[model samples]
Every structure is written in structure tokens, then in C-alpha cells.
Target: MAEFFDNYGALLAQGTIDTLVMTIASCIFAYVIGLPLGIWFAVTAPGGLKPNTAVNTVLGWIINIGRSIPFIILLVAIIPFTRLVVGTSLGVPGAVVPLTVAAAPFVARIVEQSLAEVDKDLIEAAHSFGSSNAQIVVKVLLKESLPSLVRGAAITFVNLFGYSAMAGTVGAGGLGDIAIRYGYQRFQGDVMLAAVILCVVLVQVFQSLGDWLARSIDKR
Candidate 1:
């Protein structure tokens, strides 16, 4: 046990950190792009505040196209774009671009769904008070949807975690990389098992925290 720990412990620790960095960075960037897009989607739907069918249809098709691409394929296909954005496509930074790209559309959909669930009565009440679209969005739609948004964030994080691992297969450098290198290439079952176990634990932690946070803030 000591020999095993001494041989691979630091590698695992660094891999975990890299995975986290990729996941967290990807999550932040994905939300940055997705949140406003989602608000636009909800606000411009047929029965929405603005009701521009053309804008919604175009955006919907774009998002659908983005979401339709599998991450691995997207990862390879976007190598040039990723390299242009981050200067390389081989590490934590490199992995983030594709992860963000892959996740943003999904995040947008989640946000749209959450905001769509906001009580129409609340929006009507806001409108009665002469609230502008921006005010209603910030003060009413977003406020009411905070819990669901948090939950969605957690889901996004978990997904990015998996994506980060997959990125490792291509030299993105994380637990996935470690698992592939030591566990698979070197035929070390123990190393692979440890990496898998750590991944499971991290996922559980993220999911539980998300659920707890959503529950704590949910008024309904």
C-alpha cells in the first residue's frame, strides 16, 4: 500500500486538481455564454415578453446544432478554434474551450426551462407595476429561478467532470489522462480503480451539495 501510494499518490492528486480546474472553468464560461442566451430564448418565445419568432427560431436552431455534436467529435473538430482561443489544445486550458462550447447550449436549455417555469402571474404582476423587460428579467424571472439555476449549475459541473475525463484521453491531462496512462496503457488495475473511486466520490459531493442548496433556497 505504501509503495503504491508513494508511486502514484501525487499523480492522482494533481490529476484530480486538473480535473476540477477544467470542470470549474468550463462551468463558469458555459454559464457566461448560456445565461443571457437562455434569457433571450425565454423572453423571445412566441408567447414571451418580446415575442420575436424569427430571433427565437434562429437561436434555437443554432443551439440545437451545437448540442447535437458529441463532445469527442466537437473536441477534435474545434481544435483550431480552441487553439486560437487558448493558445494550445493539450491541458486544462485547452480542454476548457471545447467543454464550454459543448456545455453552453445545454446550459442555455436548462436556463430556458427554469425561467419558463417562473409563474406567469408573477410576470403579469411585474408588468402591472410597469417593470421593463430588463427589470422583470433580473428581479422576477431570474430571482424566482435561482434554485433551479443552482441545480442546473450542479448538473453542468458534473457533466463537465465527465467531459474533462474524456478530454484526458486526448492528452488534456486529468484523472482521465492518468487512468489511461497508468491504468490502461500500463495495465495497472489498482491505479484505474483508485481513479474511478475518486471520480465517483467527487461526483457525489457535487450532486449532494447542489441538491442541498436548491432545497435551502426553494420557497415552493
Candidate 2:
């Protein structure tokens, strides 16, 4: 292990940073797009207070199609668009484009599920108070669902971390690429093992953080 660190410590460190960069940036962008989208889906779905079948169906289809494609294929499939967005398709910036795109729909679904778990009675109560649609959505739907949303955000963050590693397969520059190129291709088991450990650590850190935040903020 000392020998491995001496030889590849800097490489591993850089790879870890790149992975975090891709994961965090992608998650932020994805959630920014996904939150409103999920709210739109929830509010417009059949049985929703302001149901719109046409709008809900179109958005659902689009989100499903986006989610159904495998991330690896999505990576390659959107190369041109990635380049268009980031001006290159082989580093952190390039990876961010695909990562954000791939994660947004997934994040949307997560947000939708979290919102779905909100109490219908609370929504109705807010309605009885003469709250506007926007007021009920913000104060009741979103405020009540905050804990679930935080947990979902953490899940999305870590899941995107793994996907960012896969982006390394395309030279996106993370531990996954490092592990593949040096560990698998060159038969350096120690390097691969180290990368895998770092990934596990990341997962644990996010999981714990998410749980703590949810517990701290939850009123009931």
C-alpha cells in the first residue's frame, strides 16, 4: 500500500477531486432543472388539484424516455450535444454536460416520489385557508416534503458520483477512468482497489449526511 501510494497518490487524489467536481456540479444543475419539473408533473397529473392530462402525459413520456436510456449509451449518444454545451467532450466540463442531462430526469422522479408522499389532507387544509395554488405548493407541498427532498438529493448526489466515474470511461477524468486504465488494462489491482475504497467512502459520507439532515429538519 505504501508502495502504491508513493507511486500513484497524486493521480488518485486528482481523480477523486475530478469525481467530486463532476458529481456535485451535475447534481446542482440537475436538481435546479428537476425541482420545478417534478412540481409541474405533480401538480398537473391526474387527480392533482390542477390536473392537466396533456401536460402530464407529455412530461411523463419525456422523463421516462430520458430515464430509460442506459447512462453509458446516453454518454455516447449525446456527445454532439455535450460538445455543443461544453466545447469539449473528454474532461470534467464535458462530463458535466452528460451527467447533468442524465441525472435531471432521475432527479425529477425522485422529487416526484418525495412530493407524492406529502399528506393530501395538508394540501386540502391549505386550500381551505384560501391559499393560492402557488401558496399551497410552496408552503404545504414543498415545505412539508423538505426532509424527503433532502434525502432524495443525497441519493441523487451519490448515484451521480458513480455515473461520473463511468464518464471517465470516455476520458472524463475520474477514479473510474483511473481504475479502468491502470487497474484493469494494466493489471494494477492495488490502484483499482484504492479507487474503489474512495468511492465507498464517498457513498458513506453522503448517506450519513443525508440521514442527519433529514432527522434534524423533520418535525414529525
Candidate 3:
């Protein structure tokens, strides 16, 4: 055990940094793109406040196509785009491009679903008080749906965490890369074990924090 730690401790630390960078960066991009798209989706669906079938259909199809592609294929297929965005398709930064693309649709879907869960009565009440569509959405739908949105964000974050590790397969430089190179290729069981344990711990921490935040925000 001591020998194992001595050999791979530095690599493990680096892996943690890589994983954190990839996950956080991708989540930020996902939220920036996804939240607006989700709001649009919610507001344009059938019977929605702005109900535009054509726009919603096209946007939904695009998001669905993006979500359907497996992450591994996405990583390889978007190499050119990734390179154009980050100048390389194999480091933590480069990995963010694909990870964000892959995560956006998921985040949008989650956000839309959370918004959909908002009580229709609340929206009606806002409308009855002469609130504009934008006001109703901003003050009624989003505010009431905050807790669910937080939970969705938590789920997205965890999913992105796993994807970041997988991105290491293409030299994205995370715990996954470390495990693949030193553990699998070099037959270092200790390295693999440590990486897996670290991932588990990270997920647990995220889950706990998410639950706490969601509960705190859930005034209803």
C-alpha cells in the first residue's frame, strides 16, 4: 500500500485537478446554453404561453439528436470543432467543448421538465394580475421551480463528472486518463483502485450538497 501510494500519489492529485476542471467548465457552458433553450422550450410547447409549434419542434429535434449521440462517438466526431475551439482535442480544455455539447441537451431537457412541474395555477394567478408572459415565467415558473432545477443541476453535474473521466480515453488528462494509462496499461491495480474510490467520493459529496440545497430552497 505504501509503495503504491509513493508511486502514484502525484498522478492521482493531477487527475483530480483535471477531472474538476473538465466537469466544472462543461457544466458552466451547459447552463449558459441550456437554461435559455429550456426556457424557450417550455414557453413554446403546445398550450405554452407563447406556443409556437414550428419553433419548438425544430429545437426539440436538434436537442434530441444531440442527446442521442453517445459521448465516445461525439468526442471523436467533433475533433475538428474541438480543435478549432481550443487548439487541441486532447487536453482538459479541449475536452470541455465536446463535454459541453453533449451536456447541453441534457441540461435543457432537465430544465424544461423542472419548469413544466411548476403549478399552472401560479402562472394563471400571475397572468390574472396583469403580468406579462415574461414576468409570469420569470417570477412564477422559474422561481417556483428553483428547487427542482437545483436537483437537475446536481444530476447534470454528476453525469458530467463521469463523462470527464471518459474523455480521458482521448488524452483529456483526468482521473480516467490516469487510470487508463497507469492502471490499465501498466497493470497498476492500486492506481485504478484509488481512481475509482476518488470518483465515488466526489459523487457522494455532490449528491449530499445537492440534496441539502434543494431542500433548503423548497419552501413549498
Candidate 4:
């Protein structure tokens, strides 16, 4: 046990840190793009506040196309773009670009779904009170969907966590990189096992925290 720790502990610790950093950074950027797009989706759908079939259909197709691509393929396909964005596709910053690109469409779908679940009555009441479209979106739809959004964030984090691992294939640096270089290539079963365990622990911890937060914030 002590020998194992002595040999791989530091490496594992660094890998864990890198994984967390990549996942978190990707999640934030994905949200920055996805949140507004999602609101647009909900607001312009057929029955929404400002329904526009043309805009909604076009946006839907675009997001669908983005979501259809596999993460590994997206990782390689966007190498040039990723490098352009972050100056190199080789570490946490590199991994973040593809992760965000891959996750943003997904995050947008989640947000649209959450907002769709908002009470129609509330929206109508807000309208009767002469609230602007922007006010209703900010105060009613978003506020009411806060809990669901938190849960969606957890799901997005977990998905990005997996994608970050795949980014390790291109030297993006994370537990997945360590597992591939040492555990798989070097035939170190114990190292692979340790890395897998840590990933599982992280997923469980974050998912639980997200659920708790969602429950705490839910008013309805």
C-alpha cells in the first residue's frame, strides 16, 4: 500500500486536479454560450412568448448537428480551432475548448427543457401585470427553473468529466492521460484501477452535491 502511494500518489493527485480544472472550466464556458441560446429556444418555440417558427427551427437544427458529433471525433476535428482559441491544443486550456463546444449544445437542450417546464400560468400572470418579455424571462422563467438548472449543471459536469478523459488521448493532461500512458501502455493494472476509482468518487460527490442543492433551492 505504502509503496503504491509512494510510486503514484503525486501523479494521481496532479491528474485529479487537472481533470477537475478542465471539467469546471468547460462547464462555465458551455453555460456562457448555452444559457442565452436556450432562453432563445424557449422564447421562440411555437407556443412561447415570442414564437418564431423559422428562428426556432434553424437553431434547433444547428444544436442538433452539434450534439450529433461524437466527442472523440470533435476533439480531433477541432484541434486547429482549439489551438487558435487557446494558443495550443495540449493541456487544460486545450481540453476546455472542445469540451465546451461539445457540451454547449447539450446544455442548451437541458435549459430549454427546464424552462419549458415552467408554469404557463405564472407567465400569463406576469404578462397581465404588464411585465416586459425580458422581465418575465429573467424573473419568472429563470428564477422558477433555478433548481432544474442546477441539476442540469451537475449532469453537464459529469458529461464533461468523461469528455476530458478522452481529451487525454491528445495530451490534454488529466487522469485519463495517466491511465493511458502508465496504466494501459505500461500494463499497470493497479494504477488504472486507482484512476477509475478516483473518477467514480468525483462523479458521486458532485452529483450528490448537485441534487442537494437543487432540492434546497426548489420552491415548488
The candidate scoring highest on lDDT is 4
Which digits, one per residue and each the tens of the lDDT, describe model 1 over residues 95-191?
8999999999999999999999998999999999999999999999999999999999999999989889888755778888788777889999999
Quote the lDDT for 173 in model 2.
Answer: 86
- Provide the overall lDDT of each model, using Cα atoms, as 2-decimal numbers: 0.91, 0.90, 0.90, 0.93
Quantify how close model 1 is to the true structure by its C-alpha RMSD in Å.
Answer: 1.0
Clashes of each: 0, 0, 0, 0
Task: Give TM per candidate.
Answer: 0.97, 0.97, 0.96, 0.98
- CA shift of 88, model 4, Å: 0.9
Residue range 1-220, candidate 4, lDDT tens digits: 9999999999999999999999999999999999999999999998899999999999999899999999999999999999899999887888899999999999999999999999899999999999999999999999999999999999999999988888787777788888887788999999999998999999999999999999999987
lDDT of candidate 2 over 1-220, digit per residue (tens) = 6887889999999999999989999999999989999999998988776999999999999899989999999999899998898888888898898899999999888888888888899988898889999998899889999999999999999889889878876787898888888888999888899998988998899889999999999999
Could you tell me which residue pairs clash in candidate 4?
A: none
Model 3 misplacement above 4 A: none
lDDT of 4: 0.93
Q: Which lDDT value does model 4 have at 161?
A: 90
The digit string of per-residue lDDT tens for model 3 on 107-216 reads 99999999999888888888889999999888988999999999999999999998887887667788877777777899978788899899899999998999999999
List ranges where model 2 is wrong by over 4 Å: none
User: What value does the lDDT take at residue 132 in candidate 2?
Assistant: 96
Every candidate's CA RMSD: 1.0, 1.0, 1.1, 0.8
CA shift at 199, candidate 4, in angstroms? 0.3
